[model samples]
Target: MNDVTSGPDTPPLTKALKETAHRLGADLVSVAPADRWSEPPSFDTSTVHVYPHSGYTPSELMPSTHSVVVVAVRHLDGVIDSTTTDTKTTAIQGNFGYVLLNRKLNDITFGLAHWLEEQGYRSVPLGSAGQSRYNHRADDDPDILSVGYGVFSLKRAAVLAGLGRKAKNGVVASPELGVRMRLGALLTVARLESGPLLEGDPCPPDCTICMKACPTRAISLGGRVSHLRCFTDVGRRGVRYEEIKAKFKAQYPVDLPDVDYVDKEYWGNEGTGNRMCKIACVAFCPLGKRRLPDVMRRVKEFEQQRPKVELLSFPPSHEFALDAVGEGNSAAEPSGSG
Candidate 1:
């Protein structure tokens, strides 16, 4: 890479990168010193591991990784909120949007990487890891969902990048996006000004909305998250989606289906079909709720309108659906059929 800036002191170029990121669709952007990864995690560090192999650090991603650029895009509540339907097709429709959003975020990250490379600095973009790579486990575990490792933990990276703070729900909650954001990162040799970790917790000490909202009790009051419980429930939807897809293929062999089944990417790239159908944990959080009044109202309305079903009685093979209006509709009649 060749340097495009005037001299080695290129803070202006770093500023340009941030501006370009915003223009390229990033809702939140920040730069963190690569050294931040050297420090122990504010939470337990035992569960996290880096790739291409464990015991690696963010600085190891590139020998000259001077700064890490982190970006986040808000997951609009309406898009996720509308998918709470009992219809077998609900998960496919609702989660596809989230999948697309992640794709967009990756595109933006790569775009930033290319721009950095053009500026005479080496850049490496790290999107959500591929399923095969993300699912890879070291010798430590035999059980599923034992804190699966990745190229990097974007949430942890985002927090260190000063874009957000870790919340009790085990999510990086941003002031602008709350828990409703997806993060991506790019490592660069450019010595850009680094952002400081945001001070103070955004989550209310008295509130446990996320804990209560989780159907599987995945989140705890003490902020401990059972990755096993969360991943199992989330992954179960993918299994259900595959089953429905198989039946759909059998019943209408000749007709082309409108929606094809997408396997859930455990790395959180393409969400499982149940993504929106099970968003109560994130949607009900008060942080950044005021920014989207209509979204909050719709979520609340869906909660009131939707009939609750016992988790045990709900078929394990189906995505949990909430009775609610579709996107753009104010009201809708509940389905008579389960």
Candidate 2:
């Protein structure tokens, strides 16, 4: 509530808070200003209902002023080892670390929120929609991925939250856990000071192993992602929803309550279960420099789908690959390559 920093006499409060956060089970912790996660920087109103076209202004979402607390969870051992017989269990084991991590952070965040509230400051969790009277929508969209303060998109947010960096695979790579981490955020009404965005780029300029491994050629040279293509591939392969429900039905049914319709659409796989694109894209990226499991390869063959590309790079970020191979509305004559 107090915008003023704790004086020299109270400098340890922030330090204590950080220590408390870790003790409460946060693998990584960082402070972010509430305004940074406001809509304008992240959303497209034309496409999403929650935010305005320029971005979602805080006043439009929450009139009251405040701060934010960002948190991250690292992956656990045995989570990423593809050789594990139960692929479904293995995936959950991988992602559950973050889930548990978030749960712990929520407990601490609310305690911090309460403390701030007692000090006359307002506070809320990063993804606190539906939790209380002041909750807002947990609307993280594909187009506007960076709803919180961080670099790049969600992948980078995880990294900035101190989880890791963009792997040659495009996934966030953690130093302690490698590329095994999930990201989360907590918006608080309190006015805690925000953390510095890390300096020194962790991504490598020479590495493009993830690109080489993609099946659909969906990942561009600039690191931009194609959600539709990735999801389609995931659904068809029975890894996204079907895999989760099949393996963890007893513990974690794939029925996502808030997003059932969207999940079904994605799980439909557009009537095809051939998720070669995602398997290729994620399997081959060198971030963490890991190899694709044999199951992924066997499934690719079973689907009878062969990708036309062996090795390729996206044209300049602005150019379209289709333009080189097909006729278009432009008046220019067709090129020989097309």
All models, RMSD in angstroms: 10.3, 12.3
* Candidate 2 vs. true structure, TM-score: 0.52
Sliding window of 10 residues with minimal summed lDDT for model 1: 329-338
What lDDT tens digits, residue by residue, belong to model 1 across residues 75-157? 76565555543333445434544576667777998999999888788888885432322232312332322234444667767
**How accurate locally is residue 91 in candidate 2, as Cα lDDT from 0 to 100?**
34
The TM-score leader among the candidates is: 1
- Per-residue lDDT of model 2, residues 1-338, tens digit only: 45434446233555665676677666666665545554354433332222112223333444564544555555443333332232323234323433444455557667665655665556554431211110012122224221122211334334334445555344555545445445545444545555654333344564443343344444556565543234334344233322322332222112234642222211111122223342333332323323333423333242234343322221233121321222211121122320
lDDT of each: 0.58, 0.40
What are the TM-scores, per candidate, against the unseen true structure? 0.68, 0.52
Using lDDT as the measure, the top candidate is 1
| Candidate 1 TM-score, C-alpha based | 0.68
